[model samples]
Target: MSERLKSFIRERATALGFEACRFASASAPWDAGERLAHFVGEGRHGDMGWMETTLERRAHPTAMWPEAKTAVVLGLNYGPEADPLPQMADRSAGYLSVYARGDDYHEVIKGRLKILAGQMAARTGQDVKVFVDTAPLMEKPLAQRAGLGWQGKHTNLLSRRHGNWLFLGSILTTAEIEPDAPEGEHCGSCTACLDACPTAAFPAPFQLDARRCLSYLTIEFAGPWPEEFRVATGSRIYGCDDCLAVCPWNKFASGAREARLHAREALNAPRLADLLALDDPAFRALFAKSPVKRIGRDRFVRNVLYAAGNSGDAGLVEPVGALLGDPDPVVRDAAAWALRRLEAAGLA
Candidate 1:
């Protein structure tokens, strides 16, 4: 009966657009709490203080909800149609992480998770709770235990079929279900992800220093970027995908077909000049459904200004210069920094 229910869940998930769905015991297979403790203890999470606040709950699924007995980990692919790294060469245009170029994954994956959750509750008469990257839940480990994928050295889930471009969502339930065999590590000796990082975010395999991660700096981080990372950040305005793109396993992954997950042409390689010009209203309007909107106009433009500074295109100087006196001090500071860099390089 458990096997039948598992089959039913996986079928429904696939039909609902999830590329993969597998189950894991709510207890989790690894010492997730200790691992998290080590990460937080070493100060690797950086300014993401929330991780510290939710440490106890994130230690394990049962810690979040004692009644939960099974975890249904699901993966939704958002693979790019072409290589994203090449766009970095055009420093005048911004490179958005593939995952953020479309509708926010939280909204997209949550809707599907809720639909699947409702179906599961009806089938098993069990209480269900859904999570899509918002919770403190350790999703990658759960996904790995469920056999959806193994955690790559980059610290994101990597599937034989979906690679690293997968968004994870989970349905925790009161139902007792048999868990699937765990996926064995397939990363082998490859260090491509670690070497590809522009910020050297990874101190070692399977460990990430979020402080140096461009994605963290551009998005979660507020205030001016550290001087050291400004040039290395290149033209990436929102998030960086270098580590994910360089993975060897992506050869088995396919481009995303979900209409909502596909990149909007305008966002594919947005002009740095145009991005720097976005006022609050324009920013909101332009990125209404995009994950990039979460950072708000000031932070977003700050990232653009940094990119503009790194861009050897002197033509971008006018836009960067205009923001030097903006209301937001963060924007003003970034503008000043960009101006200095551009002027020193004779690009301003």
Candidate 2:
């Protein structure tokens, strides 16, 4: 009966656009709570105090809900068609992380998860909950346990077929399903992901220091970027994919086919000059459906200024200089930094 139910769920998931689906016993790894306590205790989560706040519930699937007997983990591939490194060579343009180049995955993935959950409940007459990054659920570890993928050295889930470019969504249900064999670590002696990080975000092979990570600094951290990471940010204005892009496993995955995840041409490599000229209204219209919209105009512009400073395009100095009088003090501060960096390079 469990096997038949699993097959039914898999068929429904594939029909719903999920690339892969696997089930795991709805129980946390033995050390999951301890690991969370340590990660939060050391202050590695940075300003994300919510990790500490929800530690009890996030520590285990059963802790969040005792009725959950199975966890359905799903993967959706968003692999880029071409290499992402070449864009960094064009200093005049801003490089957004590939994931943010299209529609927000939270909206895309959550909507799908909700549909799957509804279908599962209807068919089985069981309770279900859906999550897609917005929740405190420990997705990567659970995905690994479900055989969706193993946690790569970079701490993101990496699959033998999808690499690390897959978006993960989870559904917890009271219905029982036979669990799949857990995927074993395949990283071996390779350190490609760890070495690829410009900020050395990984303190160890599988441990990530959120504070030094460019993605966290650009998107999650509020206020101006720390002085130490400003120069390393380069022309990346949204999020960083350095580690994910360099993974050799990506060679096996096909390019992204999900229409909503496809890159918008305008965002691929937007001119830094044009980005600097954007006021609030222009910024919103430009990034209406993209994940970049969540950062808001001030924080988004602050990132643009950081990229402009690292661009080494002396031409950008004037445009960046214009932001000195901008209403947001954060933008003004970033402008000041960009001016000094450009002048130091004798581009002023």
Clashes of 2: 0
Q: Count of backbone clashes for each model?
A: 0, 0
The list of candidate 1 runs beyond 4 A from truth reads none
What TM-score does each of the candidates earn?
0.98, 0.98
lDDT of 2 by residue, 1-348 (tens): 888888988999999899999999886455767888888888899988888899999888888888888999999999899878789999889999999999999888888889989999998999999988888788888888999889889989999998888999999999888899999999999899999999999999888889999999999888888787988988989999999999999888778879999899999999999999999999999999888998899999999999899988989989999999999999999999999999999999
Best by TM-score: 1
Question: How much is the lDDT of residue 37 in candidate 2?
Answer: 84
Could you tell me how far off, in angstroms, the CA of residue 25 lies in candidate 1 after the best superposition?
A: 0.4
lDDT for each candidate structure: 0.91, 0.90
- Superposed by TM-score, candidate 1 places the C-alpha of residue 43 at a distance from the truth, in angstroms, of 1.2
Candidate 1 local lDDT, residue 222: 95
Q: What is the overall TM-score of model 2 with all chains considered together?
A: 0.98
Best by lDDT: 1
Expressed as tens digits, the lDDT of each residue in 43-128 for candidate 1 is 98888999999999999999999899999999888999878899888988999999988899899889989999999999999999
